[model samples]
Target: MKPAIHPAYRPVVFRDKAGDFAFLTRSTMTSDRTTEWEDGRTYPVIDVEISCASHPFYTGTARVLDAAGRVERFEQRYGRDGGRR
Candidate 1:
């Protein structure tokens, strides 16, 4: 641990607006924005596009790719024997 050479590690808030979720945690990242947490304290807030709360895997809303449909479409485009003769 060096003196004053390392970035400050402090409590910050990560917010997922789409999911309406936020959590307090320590981070070295900084933000000009601030928000009042549930504990009645203000902390730097970082807005994220996706988090566990809104992620497909975590929420179990992942889309299953239609591989069979894709194969059918490809065959239709190129013929059954891959457009050879």
Candidate 2:
């Protein structure tokens, strides 16, 4: 409703250094870094450490430990591994 009060919601390019992935989306963030986009227009280029592209959880690269096995081992020492009843 207010003029110039809201941030610029334009397409932005987010680059991941390690994963070598670049995603384009609309964002209100501003940056000084510029790069040539697919449309042949140069825009601000922002570098990010992690995103859904590089994150372990999103990529299913996260290691899942066996906590249940560890709990059973601990119960065996406490003499409660025979049954749960």
Candidate 3:
């Protein structure tokens, strides 16, 4: 609500190169890099390592951890009594 004290919020682009995905949204973040969006206008672009498009959870490609197997291995190594003896 202050005048000129807050960072400027403007249209920017978030790019996920690995997923070949990009989106335009309003953000206070700035960048020297720019890209031409679908609207033929240029906007500051930010490169992100991961996004919903490429995230395992969002893509339903997440690997289920074998917790039972790990527990079995640990028991085998230390015994059921945790090797207290």
What's each prediction's TM-score? 0.74, 0.72, 0.77
lDDT of all the models against the reference?
Answer: 0.96, 0.87, 0.96
Query: How many Å off is the CA of 62 in candidate 1?
Result: 0.5
- Against the true structure, whose TM-score is highest? 3
Model 2: per-residue Cα lDDT over 1-85, one tens digit each: 9998998899889999868798788898899898888889887889999988889999999999999999888888776845656
Model 3, residue 79: C-alpha shift (Å): 11
Each prediction's number of clashing residue pairs: 0, 0, 0
RMSD of each: 3.3, 4.0, 2.6
lDDT of 3 by residue, 1-85 (tens): 9798999999999999779899999999999999999999999999999999999999999999999999999999989999788
